[model samples]
Target: MSHQTGIKANEKLIKVFGKSKNGKLRVIKVSIENEELNCTATAEVKKDWERDYDKLIVPLIEESVPCYILYRLDSKTSLGYAWLLLSWVPDTATIRQKMVYASTKATLKNEFGSSHITEELHATNKEETTFDGYIRHKQDFAAPAPLTSREEELVELRKKEINTEINTDTRHQTLGGVTCPMSDATVAAIKDILNGTYDYLQFRIDLEEERIHVSKAAVVPLNELPRQVPTESARYHLYLFKHTYDGNYQESFVFIYSMPGYNCSVRERMLYSSCKAPFLDDLNALGVNVMKKLEIDSGAELTEDFLHDELHPKKFVNSRPAFAKPKGPPNRGPKRLTRPQEQSF
Candidate 1:
């Protein structure tokens, strides 16, 4: 769907946000809403600017499968798009888990720096971060007063402009509620730190340095004494996954998280009973031959596929019916593969 008329880039129909101060890309849930059949979609900052239709974006419109598209919109001149193959497209009642892992990229020298919140981990971008790193914060909060009367007037004018444009913002208006993975653990952690349960522990994180700055005023790192932090249930959900065969069960671990922001990636699932891995390695070993064994089909991810079969996969038999069970872009060039075949490499 090419929304290329008056839609401004500052006000994007699709948004990219979330992910803690860490590199974790906060998982987002999207479903087809008012315009279900409008697969011909496009967005732009200005009407006259060229609209480069990405081939991958076209195949993200499907009925059964909930599509996850990666949109990095800087402006009309600087932009990028891709289709994200979700690991599992759960029902409306989806769960978001808080897991942590460290990945070291072996790029030629060091080319790929962190780009968005979805990008969990990458080599440090010291140069860019030091100069152009932007600190994104919640906007509903109050801001410090401007130094001059002129500045105050400008702020008020800007605020008025924002108010006029607020209704068009579909990004913050979450169409669904998410039950994050660590609800139980998150509750306990917040209760302990945020509540008066503890003596007042101020915690902060430096996104650039990738360091946890925690301490009481005028104190030191937790070097008061040697101790081990809690690594119990924390590890269980870190890379929580299951490995199951037909009736029988096996072990598996997710070798990769989000792919290089591309189209039609297969995130497999298992069927067996439940178990916990206190270590990531133990869980990773379980999913050894997953792609090698189960991947059944591969083909060109064309616009037809994006809007039909390839973008969305079928749900499991026993799964409940989803609330809005349906749901990207323009690629005018010759048809191309919407997704890359994992086995072909």
Candidate 2:
């Protein structure tokens, strides 16, 4: 019976026992199937010897079977080839495996050949299992309905809360409730240092106060600020204050601390104060300045003032130029004057 079949790339076709009409084992028609392309071919064998059949025809047939090639073998003499057609066999795993085994035996007759093949098979299986497990895990994660709306909302809220707490705590730590000392001596010392009058000196307590006030009043916010730890052990807070072009104050503050018995250097202190503290101070100063600039104490006042300024102006000036008398040039081209002779006529 004929059967329709598909073939694979690595399938093998086997030759079953068959005979020709001559009954002399003459016409050997080998039937093989191509697994990949699902085609068929017939080859005529020249010899009926098993060794010769295994050597040439078997290998070719085995290789072709899995690759979608179907074949029927025929017998041949010195003059020409003849056929002893046989029924086609379906390509099966057992058949292919047998063909592979035969081919391996034919090719690798050494004792270690079988062992090497076995090791390869074992390795392949192990890798297959590993790959399968990975695929399964990936599929599990990709499954639908992992998170419900409520769960997603909760996650987002948690993240927001965490961020808020972090920011508040950071602020609290940096600007510790304790007021910084602002002494007169410290202020004078700071001024001297800034003026290049002194190379390096600690601010006296009295000067420090004056310095703080002057610095705070003239503070301008720097672009970048240093990070500070929000812990009780933190030693000092850094701040920056600068004067704006519009005569507004900008200030930033940062908390700073050094290890016990380790005083901060002048450069370090300057950097911390100029960068970190000033950044925070600037945010605060901006809010304050915005309020002060508009001359409003509250949002309500600001809105009222904004409307007043936008809707009406105290005085208005006309931009157009005033009319003036023409001067210098007289009318030219055609004269419009009446001639005395024409008038008389």
Candidate 3:
């Protein structure tokens, strides 16, 4: 026995266009070839194209005219093919109309009666509201309310919690040692604790029975750290000794402390040593020699040993022979005049 079978296929939906009361056109419907009311376009208007009664009005419609049919939804009457929607036309402003509007606005008030409109047109072409004005408008719409006493207390508590968390995180990250002093917020918090705003513990450093106690709450401010300002002692010293014997010493000390090496105390001691009067004098002497070699100054204190070691170390090693005076030829007496000279005259 033979049996008959049926087959089915999916179909594509055709788009239907409609016009609004404001004269703006929009897509109305889309459905399968045989299906009714299968899908409809939402209220969102397509930004790039406008749908007229039975046609899509696009910028490129002039290039190739496509056939389109319009249908009335209620009456189901065919409106016929349309190339361009009569409602969709170029919007043009007349000079008189522009002048009338420009005369009222403050921005264009001066340009309304001017001889040339180019200047005013250029100025108005790039007009835009500033960010500050937009932000002010936003704030004006939704202003916050004043906090109550309890709310203020709660805010203070939260602030303290946040500060504590930040401090803990910073300490954990800098477990070895701080590269620099504490920031303003951390310093202020420490100062508050030190001033008895909050209770804090003390740490003791014992050295040979002498105990030096420092409060954990008290922290040096960031401004007190070694900074790049000329007024800072370390920076000032570094500047003065930059071309001197202490140049390398100061650089090494800053690097050692910044990197937090094992011998930090030794580096600190060396820095203090360089700041002494005798060391500073030696550094100044070296600086003077450097300046002299550069032909900038002749008053540099050029000691014999300094000149030998620093200025001409290699030349001093291979001592060149001193220049000797050259011997002159023996002097000769004047010759006596002969009798032939009288004949020549």
Candidate 4:
């Protein structure tokens, strides 16, 4: 995600991009502070602005510090004044700094009016911060090397592959194929669970055939639910929780979705996630009223106690003593009065 500009940065940018500036604002250097972009320095256009580029911009950047430089180009377009966005992420900078600067570059340009930014120059070292280096960078982009016949074929093939993948996925999703269709066995297992023939039911996606199949179905006890979860893949579990809560015998249909953490591939995770809601809907349509839903990364977390806590959360009754009003002082009897005796001279 992109970071936003700080208040100071926004205020300074308004002046730099606005028409009220009386001074010749040539360059504005921006830095990241507390994950927000703020203006660190600004340079005014001097008589020899080209010669002073290094003196004005290079000093603000460091070997370990990443910064952004907004330099006003001499060329002006019909939209407004053309500006060059310089992204200075040095090689010695931390990984986090590099990521933040990269993500925030677009935001900085957008806030300052993207139309005004005619070109962008990325620099990683002191040498690239010079005017000559920027010219060379522009030249390299202006005229790229020509591709050979084989390379051209490979490029076309790559484009076709991407387009085909996207179109196929879109077609599948539109036709409700992204969430694999449930097989007959899977549907039968779901029915068995609803009829109480099975206490637990689990499903797995067969990616090759693009179908969901019943991987496991048995009378698993509440305590053994954790053992039934697959350790290396994602599965959907439907369990019948029959427990007595507060002397009342209760039976609830619980749905537990478990994934074996990052060990599962991204494709597996995405497929499971996309199929979850539709699978649950299928169960519900078949008369399985799931009372509770739980999502977990590991099966070990699916203990009986965890399910109990989730199904019947412990209610806290305010046990502190209530405030008591103080009693009024008891009525006192009238006191006798005495007069002082006069002294003789």
Candidate 5:
């Protein structure tokens, strides 16, 4: 589902912002009240912009509350105003409050012209809201200094190595084909599944770190496959289905890709898609002959009957026999010349 911009900028905020330059307003603290972004408080410029950092902006912040501080800088922008959007979302704030502030940030900036926002600051702590912290934040994102000849050579070599690695598929000993290396525990779990100790294995991807790890592994029955899938996120499932087909017992390895469609983000869908083919290739390289591959949008679709139909499809046959000509009556004599009396007219 798409994220909804629930918080709207209030009319009072617009009016206050129009007069901010003349009113000497150094900072405007915007907050969510009744689901609208209202001007909760403001700080006036005492002497200059730098002096108000400690004297004005410091005292307005509450520990548990998340707020947006529009700080005016002395630097001028092309729009005749240079403002910094300081997103002061504290760690102590509630999850809902944090989500609201994060989602509404772009909308807030767009409502009040984005061109005036020269810089943005995201601070979770009181220390980061200080002037020194702002300087450090700028330095962290600042452009790097020029490199020496030797340093340039080293950088070029590293780039070449990275490009080579990207162009060529390098199979690690532990995690074979996946770009996101699987955890040691996940490798061991996969071994257990291959060895018949476990009949089911599930995996989850760490999107931030770009790693794949085992989420669950157990000896689950065929009917329990649906329950094993999570409903909120995407997952990779390996199931060993043991059932009787044609009066013979057989074991088939089934690979299931379960994605909770609307629940997953766009990044999640892309990550899972890129990893899927390589993961299957790795499984095949490890001696797993996957008999059936299934993709599902929900756990409810991963049922025993569904798997059975995928594994063994019904065959059509012609039950009716071929048509044949019947034998003619045997002729006992030539013809009994019984010329019927010419119709006695």
Candidate 6:
């Protein structure tokens, strides 16, 4: 989906997009077709924040990192997308768990917003290196250790290794010949996921003793699709990190209109409109670069200044036409009496 505007940086949704049950973030499997992303920043994290960042914060950043390359689709700059540097303490409060400072809006609009975060994830681009390492200033800076020793420990301390074996079983045809009008890249990505039905996936990784856990469930709605999309929206929200087994990390698409009670509210029902196609266009516009970034980060260099001028054209993004409010009666003065007519007669 296109990067939504007015998205607060520290929102819980962004923080936990790929979180699984038990609260221990796991690299379930990324089907590409397969995928993932990266970047880093600097911050002085407190003890509490450092603890959470090690377990929680890092995963959140990894999942959404692809979004940065999306800015490459925008016509505004040479780089094409917004720059982001997430500092645990600076963006979100360790206590409240919500962002408490400087303008995320302005920050996201301008790439390189975080001085310490400016270190590109792929700068070193090591395989197995998923999250762009952040600097914990409260702790003494070690020129040698890019990632925390604890993180290194986690990487090394393999309690048990389980395979998240992935297989491509299903192939998809684009909504019965009604193709989505998206960029080739975006279209391919969608086709990649849809091509296979995630029949099932399961496994487990013992993370840091793997003790505590939390039950997670959600309804992640797909962006409103244009009327032209022929695919049927699924009725249920597929489990976030799994289908049933321990490590099943398959995710499913959530159709906006096809959802149960999606239009249940009378007022909200009035707001329904047919702009799904335009939204798809916008997503595809952003998809090409996002895909490029994803590819380059796999083990190559993606220059921060890679420039592209053509933008995915969007319509009615900001325009809000009046919907339900009644139109006022036309201004008409009461019959001016027969005086003028009678005088003329």
lDDT of each: 0.24, 0.30, 0.26, 0.74, 0.79, 0.26
Cα deviation of 48 in candidate 1 (Å)?
11
TM-score of each: 0.16, 0.14, 0.13, 0.44, 0.48, 0.17
Best TM-score among the predictions, by candidate number: 5
Candidates 1 and 5, the one with greater TM-score? 5
What are the per-residue Cα lDDT tens digits for candidate 6 across 52-75?
434433443442222232101111
- Over 4 Å off in model 1, which ranges? 1-70, 76-97, 101-111, 115-183, 186-345
Question: Judged by lDDT, which candidate is best?
Answer: 5
Model 3 residue 235 CA deviation in Å = 32
Off by over 4 Å in 4: 1-178, 320-345
Model 4 lDDT tens row, 95-191: 4465567667777876677888888899878889898888788888889676655675565345334234555445244323244788776777787
Q: In model 3, what is the error at residue 48, expressed in angstroms?
A: 25
What lDDT is reached at residue 23 by model 6? 23
TM-score, cand. 1 vs. native = 0.16
lDDT tens string, model 5, 19-47? 77563888899998898989999877777
What tens digits encode model 2's per-residue C-alpha lDDT throughout 82-125?
A: 32111222223233333333333222213212221211111111
Worst 10 residues of 5 by lDDT: 169-178
Clashing pairs in 3: none
User: Which residue runs of candidate 3 sit more than 4 Å off their true CA positions?
Assistant: 1-133, 162-345
Candidate 4 vs candidate 6, TM-score winner: 4
The alpha-carbon lDDT assigned to residue 190 of candidate 4 equals 83
